[model samples]
Target chain A: MDWKRYLFIALIIIALFSVVIFVGKTQTPPLVIAMSMLATTLMVATPLTLGALSGVFCETSAVINIGIEGMMLAAAFFGWLAAIYMNTIFGYEPMPSLITGVVVAVLTGGIFGLLLAVLSITFKVDQIIGGTVVNMLAIGITGFLNRQLFFEKNSVFGGQVPHAPGTLPIIHLPVPKVVGGVCSLFTADGCPTFANALGKVFDQRPIAILAIVLVFVSHYVIFHTRWGLRTRAVGEHPRAADTVGINVTRVRYINVVIGGLLAGLGGAYFTLESVPSFEPLMTNGRGFIALAAMIFGNWTPIGSWAAALVFGAAQAMQINLQFFRDLIPPAWSFLQQSYIVGLTPYLLTMLILTGIVGKTVPPAADGQPYEK
Target chain B: MSENKRSFQDALSESPLVVPILAIFTSMVLGGIIIAWAGGNPVAAYIGLYQGAFGSLNALSETAVWATPYILAGLAVAFAFKGGLFNIGAEGQLALGAVAAAWVGYALPDLLGAELPRYLHLTLALGAGTLAGLIWGAIPGWLKAHTGGHEVINTIMMNYIALNMTSFLLNGVMKDPSPTNVIARTPLIAETARLGTLFAKYRVHWGFIMALVAAAIVWWLLERTTFGFEIRTVGANPDAAQYAGINVKRIITWTMAISGLLAGLAGAVEVTGLNYRHELGFSVGYGFDAIAIALLGKTHPLGVVLAALLFAAMRNGGTRMQFMTQIPVDIISVIQALILLFVAADAIIRYIYRLKASEDKLVLTRGWGG
Candidate 1:
């Protein structure tokens, strides 16, 4: 509705893009560099998109799922463990075994989500602490099980001989060369084969594609469906929803559980998709970053997708810091450390949360216990 | 619900410890089941755990050593809880404090080009560390006060920033430079800055004693002082506090600063009293453990002391438990989490134990938008 605001924002983003290109380009042909950056941004955005969607679902139903990190952790370990169990113990092929792993991961997340639901809803626990308990449980249980099942000699420390097993296969999509090829005609020398540009992005694995599809699906489901209305109603006013004959408890439980299922898929992305091996603390702080994205996006699925991509770009920028180093003069070598650039996403998150300009609205009933 | 008119003493007399005791018992029962499921005899493992925590003078002293940091961190969280704030940035605050104190301990002597007196040097080191934590904690507090930025998210973000910044600085500038030192740690503090061990061949130091005194001080401040009265009033109902002419915003900022100060003291004591140095890996989960301690202690000062000892015993004894029964030391973490779960949601404990609910229960952090 506000055309001026949209135009101004678009201009700013275009200006920022031009600045990045001007400062980053070198003798190495800018087109290839730019395409790879896009690919990496998509790569980093995959898990964050799923995590933010899960956050949106839970918060829309008035439950704050701070345990998303823990759920992802639990699902990550269990998913890999399931794969190991099926392939090594049961002697199954990778396809069936990987499916089983995905199922287990989803179920693990659902169970943890159920625990959070029971604690925060039925027992009326402090929601934040309840989520924290789930996180602690995930870490402790996974670590304890890791030692018993995987550690060599089952010793108190030192030996870490892990069991290797089968993994999921990646699905490469068709190249977007035809469209990219046309766009490159505008460039003076047709920098690189635009096919390489399109191919770089399409070479993504299965979960990455699913993340893109889920972003659209989640956006539509939240905005265009009857269930979305009930969720929002319950989040804003459970009493009013109840008066209107909606089952507030059932809606919250279903939404939160579904949220957990999405979180589990995000977790599996780490073990089954991102990398093959399951390491302790592998999920890292991505779950928290996803939370930040959710807040920054104002709890909307489409908005979260964009916010997550920005964060992903931030990380990608650091990983490909040679481009940034090219910006610095050769004489100022001391200022070109990658570590300093790695601070971007976190600092960006803090700045976003600080909201120097306007207030970001959160779900009204988030972290509150419903009283019948 | 009808007992609101009862005095505080009457309330205490009417089974104040029932929920916490029930929570502890329930968690232990759950933990026993877990241990049994893991193919170890729960009774033997617990017996071994008990022995390891208190079997000898060394075990008792080790438990005390663990409790030193736990008490300070727990009190920090507890103090914040009293003010209706969740100070999850304790981990960051602790690290900043440790690094600051280490810088003061080693660098100060060299910077002055003279050997400073023990009293002044130690105080200055600790004061600097506390000041660092105070400033770190105040930023989030200030943001929450002015911008309505949520402290929980800001604090967690600060944890990452603090940790990575500490890592970068440690590797670049403050890294131990001796041939044998490959790790990211600072050099040992000056002899004058190091705390004296309490006894021969024992690791416990004056820090343990200081922790107890600190607990007493927190108790007295919360219960006796007018400043604390204002804090409690603000925590209970900010609108009321504002109507009473109390500076609610200032109280919040001060509460967080003091909480950070306590956490900073924990780091400072750990450096001077036990390790005599700061490392990137030292005191990793003490801040998280402190939350459980604070909750398990019913957010009371003395209760925190006892709860810290309990947690410390479990942590200190975990190694022996693992050594004897081959159980993972993470069981302690599991049990601690269970305890927090039961404590945070006492309705489950009360239902299981068939205990009557008490009036005027403690409140944790407010919901979103509060």
Candidate 2:
């Protein structure tokens, strides 16, 4: 990595640690409390990172992809649907059900991505309108599907998938005693230790770690590979790229489709991985949050993941604080204002965007069509 | 050749008619299938929607009552979109307006320590609502013009500030002092300031007519005069408009203020005409739904009127459909979503219709740099 990029990352880590320490001191939280916060934060951060990474491809390719929330919601619904079907009619068991769920979810995301591509590229529709439509379409299709196929009467979807018997959940690792003590300081509660005291220090989810890997992979794919170079070139200057033999529209379509598939896979996490059952309108606004993170991260995969972590941490902190509201001061102790508390992530995002310098820049040709 | 000419004359159509009409029809058809798939008769559910909205005198009254605020809010969004601004803060502005109007409606009599004259009290309530909206809209407008801050970000931020402030007021400072009143709402308005029903027993009031009149005024403002021209010019391209000597920033600010005025009026009218007071649930998602209405209506005054009524039908019918079919009311939200999707992404619809793509397009944002 370049010295500047490394410096920027180190500064961010320092800032995050400083905030964590400051919050710890101010609240005088117990060690367990800190661990819970860290773990919760990682859980929240994983899907967010996945979604933002999904957003990176679409936004990078000049599609707004506002439909991320819808995509996630649809995928979650379908994933649950697959799981429910597996446990009921097929008797095919949970493992296969999860695989099917992931496949179906990715397919849904691809469909929506296709819609976005056709609208913005073929018809040259407004990206905002396209995004809004995606959100609404998702809401409508899901709501309609839930009512017709899932919500009412003892339907297949309302049932739960049985967990595979004898699945091992990691709790502890055999680490060298001295090194373990050092790692424990940064480690969050509920984290499975790595071998020989070389534990993952952050309160990290397995999916979150996967998401980090996806970010680096995405960065490499976008900036290093031939396709990545072409996609970036097309997005930045389609006319220039076209002259140099790049197919701008085709690249946008491919990238958007891949992004949708990733988002769809993320959707499965919410249903099959994060929680079991799917609720109506369950995705809430995570898609929009991801979109915001993508913007805040300036449309790079790794940057988007970093931004998602910040968002995840904020969400985790809110939940943790809610659980320990008693420790809060009486002046700010307005429990009924939980709705306002939930809005912390959004508020912080806007504040950061406004305050920070030169981060969150859009791709050069973002929201534009290549018409040559 | 002669027959072809005659056939062509018969086939002449208004340019924008087919798309929106088809979009609406397709949504209804899809909604019907959804209802049918849920084990409810599609026709029956639709009948319920129609009956709930316009079947009887009571339904008509309720429909009008619902349509009143929707029309006003729809106009608010449409007006701003015409001026090339997305006023997503309408929800916040509407809430503040309701709170302000509610304060005036109930607290004004107490501040004076006696019941005031009818016309004067009503005027005060409306003025407060309008002023609240004006201030809300102007802040972001001024910020956008002067500081080059995007209105989308500002409006979203304002929504947080406005909502939190409203919550604090409703929960703390301006909360009802009456021992019996535990709900987060203001006191009741005096009978004189309250808008009476036009029909003897119907809930429909003067505000429905007022909303219609407001729509007409919006139509006039956008199409008739020079200021409307300036607003349209700025909306079309502020840079080009500036080159043509228009005061772009001032127009932008004015457009937002006007939009906010209409939004505020939506809340005010609801308090005066339908609800008779502002409470927590008096205005819920009307402002946000107005965006859908504005878009489906194609951002025209007449279109907004039609779109508002259509949305009002779905919202009104949704309850009965749920009550009868055991389907959730969120189904209506789905159909509305479908309509928005079809209208916004006309490619699918266009492909289905086999229509040539229209050269004119809806460019909602100017991207980042432009």
Top-scoring candidate (TM-score) = 1
Q: Which candidate is the best by DockQ?
A: 1
Candidate 1 similarity to native, TM-score: 0.93
Q: What is the C-alpha lDDT profile of model 2 across A54-156, one tens digit per residue?
A: 8888877777676787788888777677666655645634566666666787788888878777777877778767766676677666766666565556444
Chain A vs. native, model 2, TM-score: 0.81
- Name every residue pair that clashes in candidate 2: A140-B334
**Stretches of candidate 2 exceeding 4 Å from the true structure:** A1-36, A89-100, A148-151, A154-178, A181-203, A277-279, A330-340, B1-13, B108-113, B146-149, B153-193, B277-284, B321-329, B347-351, B354-356
Whole-model lDDT, candidate 1? 0.81
Write the residue-wise lDDT of candidate 1 on A122-146 in tens digits: 8778888888888888887887778
